[model samples]
Target: MTAASPRIPSPLLLGVGLMLVAFNLRPALTTVGPLLAAIRMGTGLGTTGAAVLTMLPVLFLGIASVLGPRVSRWIGPDRGILLASAVVAAGLSLRALGGLVPLFAGACVAALGIGLAGVLIPGLVKREFPGQAGLMTGLYTMTLCLGAAAGAGLTVPLQDLFGGSWALALAAWALPAVLGTLAWAPFARPSRAPVAARSEVTRPVVWRSPLAWQVTGFMGLQSSLAYIMFGWVPLILHDRGLSAVDAGFVAALMSVGQAPAALLVPTFAARLRDQRGAALAIIGLTLATYLLVVFGPLWLVVPATLGHGFGLGGCFGLGLTIIVLRVRDAAGAAALSAMAQGVGYTIASLGPLGFGLAHEIGGGWVLPSTLFCALSLGAAAFSLGAGRNRQV
Candidate 1:
């Protein structure tokens, strides 16, 4: 008798699990920005220290992403994600204990979890929703942005609710991670029979491919912009004369704007013959809106923030979509996902750190703004190659 195929969960269950897991990915990073001032006051952290704290999650994200494929191969993606969620929950809890050591340690642990999920989820989407890659990627990216928005917007209120304890506010995000772990548990049950593996010869070595490098460059550059928003935009707004609450709300608005664009951009881009125009348009919008937020009339800030969010969200979604588009098979997607996110996020970690240093050294936002514009141009250049209609 032929061996029975392993049972699979219903599509609805799988989709819900995937999104819930995605929701756990960003709060660990976003919550820190709005709470940075309070945390620094409590912990005696200076601007440089704050920048290092902000950069830690992103730096570890790259490190853990490099290990994702190997971990998935050993434990299976579902189980790996389950473990990641649990780690995130634990890290967030640790971060709430109120000290510099715990804070940095927790951030690193949480980032590692986020990174593993980041690398594994794309391959899972490509494997499970092959025909609906664009739609699913859009949905996935939208959920991710919503998570970020929630963290950015709710954190200050949460601090108030906790009677001005930033630690408690930061700790509140752990609940989602715990919930995600439980929600994904059923799907993470090990298979009854061992699965067979494909030959190594068929897997593409994406590290050597120029097309893969182009995609990685786009992912990194665009992500640098996204992380800058996540890490510094609230503080930037505060410096422009907004209250902490107002600054956080504006940052959250930017993240909220990302939702619709994240949902639409990839779906639209996937339908086009080449995504180069879409890529260039997104970069242009990003640059213009960001400049307006920083230097244009104060009255224009809200609309400009929204436009910035939309552009960055589209840029991020397109970056993820390009990973799927550039490869032909699920295995190829997994391999390329690992390479792009691994090296790409490593490159991305520099942006927030550089921005912070520039702000401190120059005593203004102008230097940082220049750096941001330069990164946008670099991303635009790489997008030209990454958005081409060719598979690696």
Candidate 2:
């Protein structure tokens, strides 16, 4: 028998692939925020009522996640990302061209695109760079957060680039989506080992694992907090007398700050015996920041902003990193990622709705702030459970 020729893998190409995949993940969901004003005017949406619209993309992350593994099984992880990227472009196109119904519908569709690719790309890192999972995940995740920041920060400018039509603004995002999708076109032929090529496996043990719930719960609660920041922080700042632009800058800072945390937290998680101290510190800071943003004196904004930004980055990164680290192997890691992110994002959508309701019910920031504090405390309780040294 002839010996198989040696294969060469380019870290450069792989790194580029990782960044492209990460770039497409956030624009679908977060780009809405910077353009919320236009969307509100176009659709006649109020804050509390807009939750359905806001939540759709976030909620469907779970829905997309449900479809990811099946996609990887058929197409393999790398190819699956390409498919998802195209879906993102399609969804963004749909978002740009359609009216109100189309707008919300497109959001869900774009979310679906993000959702599948979201689950698969992490699996790609695990598959392609088996020896350097932590470093790869960190780099990939930092790109993801940076994409989020860019989407949020640039939406208005992008919209203005085309004579300021909301439709045009919304559609403007599709260009990047198309670019990223095209950029990831290489490595589409299929990997050597498809997920289904292995023996059929049922992981009821994962279902039975307490650590699974901890991971899921931590992912869910922290995600809720982060989404609240995404969906409402600007509004809160506006309430406190900043213009929409200023509030947006604050929100953008939080999203951007997530980059550092995404880069560092995975390394930290890898080193720690248990992640409890890290989790507690982040949770406490998040709580304190929320207090300052909602109820603290005006001068406290600077520190609160930093604390908020730092907490968000670490919490978001560490949550995903934990899922990957806690699992035993690539299969297990992929499964944990699917379960944590699928359910986690679905549950996270509740934060915006809850915050909106609190504002409606109490007629001021006090009630909403109190409500968030309670939620943050609940997250802290779960983090304690999740941070233990255990396998998912």
Candidate 3:
């Protein structure tokens, strides 16, 4: 008898695949932070060049996300994601080989893959697990946070383990990408039945919807803060006299807080009438955390890290959850997701680059910290409107 075909997909299998993919999404990005100082010194990149290095991937993410819908149409969700995972694997592997050009190029490639996956994964959840968007998104986001924390916390040790070769350490993350691609390949084949099919529309409904824009605003604002923390917190701590390893540990502490919030907040928010109160509270707490980071004594760093992380985890998960809740069908969800992330990431890309420039110009973290305060207040303002209970 012929060998049996691969086992048919089951919910448990799909869930595992989703978690694996989610786990892979952030390593390529987060690994850079722990190694930022090494990268700058090794490559002779000044602050501006370093900023560009950090910004390029996020910029590519924005640009790629904008094309997500078209790509989805071309390859279908299953193949599109498979292609993205392949890109991530190739990028991470290439980046590990050494040299500034390879480093930037590899990051851009991985970001492109991440961009496509970032847009499509939510739509996939909306379509496949229609009744469980909250739980799935929570699981997916929590895994994302866990992956990020692992990358940030481990890269330095990995570098040391490899005899202080940052290149090898960066390359190590590629393994998970390869594994994720393998885990996802079987499930990436297109399904026959389309999800939540709707009639063709003449205009882009999501673009014109106020609610869509508000959701996009929330996404952009929250992401701006998250990326800043990811891109600079280690460096910031290092500047404040902490050693690289210690800085990484502190950053990891912040990241650790994200996992629980990412796991729980979306599910909780889904049950609320208007998520405004919760959203505002999180933002307010985040602002307070920033203040502590900026001016509080070193002894307070642990709590500050935890508070900031919890805020980011809840805020980010809730932003994605809003996209799912604000729409009616999978089609709308896809459109909304693409728009929010496309425009949102495009806006958020500036945070790291801009803050990097601020530090360079001011020659210290104080000016940048002030700017972050303004950004925190602004994000809070936008969250007010975005958190309203209105469907797009």
Candidate 4:
């Protein structure tokens, strides 16, 4: 007689735990930008130093993602996720302490947790929710968008609540991570031995696959554009005469739009035989965002931000979905996921810094917008190859 399938966690518990993990992935880094001005003033860090603090976590995210498989190997995937959640909590808590050194250290630590978790989650979805990859990806991505919006919108209010202390505001974000870790605890045991044994025998040669590279390129390019928006879009609006408050609002609104788009895009993408139409849709929307940033009217900024966020969210969701679609099984999914994010994020880390230099040298937003439009086109080209209905 066939052995019974190993018991999986309840669908409700699994999704909740997954989304909670998703929720913490972005807050650690995204929250810092809003408080950068205050942080600079409080710590007496120069512009260059502040820039490093902002960029450091992203750098580590890309670099540390290569460690995901190894970490999972040490502890099974379930326990690995638990460990990542704990790391995120520890990192966020460390940042709560008052000092420049702790602040930088905390960001790196948190990003390391986010990056490793990032690599593992796609594989987890593939293994645990195999039939609903698209739906699950969409849900997790929606939570990610909401979490980012919450962080951006709430941090200042939280700072005010704590008597204008940015440190306290930054520290407050750690609470959700702690909650996520606890929520995940019940399902955090090591993967069953039979599943682990099967995974070891079925590893995919992802590094040598051209389709895998295309997926990785798509992931990298889209992320590059997203990080640029995260770092500069609000500042661009502020420079164009919007108040700091209004600029932040527009940025947060952009993030809010990402949720619905992320919620819907992957579902549609999964139904299509190939994702070219979906990818072209992304290109079209992203192009509109750049145009609005360059020349849209003040009254239109809100809608423009909404459209921008929507396109970004869709692109991001599609990128994750494609990683799953292209691979054949959990082993391939894990390898491709880790490879794409490890190298993809490293490539993405250049976007904000390079765009900043370009803006400074060109003395305006015009040239930078032009460059990103060109990069968006490149992403579309890569997506064409990646979106093909073929397995890696």
Candidate number with greatest lDDT: 1
Computed on alpha carbons, the lDDT of every model, listed in order, comes to: 0.89, 0.76, 0.85, 0.82
For model 1, residues 260-376, the per-residue Cα lDDT tens digits are: 999999999999999999999999999999999999999999999999999999999999999999988666777788888888999999989999999889889999999999999
Clashes of each: 0, 0, 0, 0
User: Candidate 2 clashing pairs?
Assistant: none
- After superposition of all CA atoms, the RMSD between model 4 and the true structure is 2.5
Per-prediction TM-score: 0.96, 0.93, 0.95, 0.93
Tens digits of per-residue lDDT, candidate 3, 102-190, equal 89899999999999999988888887789999999999999989988998899899999999888889888889999999999989876
How would you encode candidate 2's per-residue C-alpha lDDT over 1-392 as one tens digit per residue? Answer: 98664354587887886688787788666777766766788678876666666777778888888777788788777788888888888888886675787788788888898888878876677667777777777787788878877777777777678777676777677888888888888767666654534522235666677788788889888888887777777677777887656666666777777788788987787678888888888888888888888788978775687678778878877787787778656667777778877888888878777877887788788887777788777777777877788776
Give the Cα-based TM-score of candidate 2 against the true structure. Answer: 0.93
Candidate whose TM-score is highest = 1
**Looking at model 1, how many pairs of residues clash?**
0
Off by over 4 Å in 2: 1-8, 194-201
lDDT of 3 at 330: 70
For model 2, state the Cα shift of residue 114 in Å: 1.5
Steric clash pairs (candidate 3): none
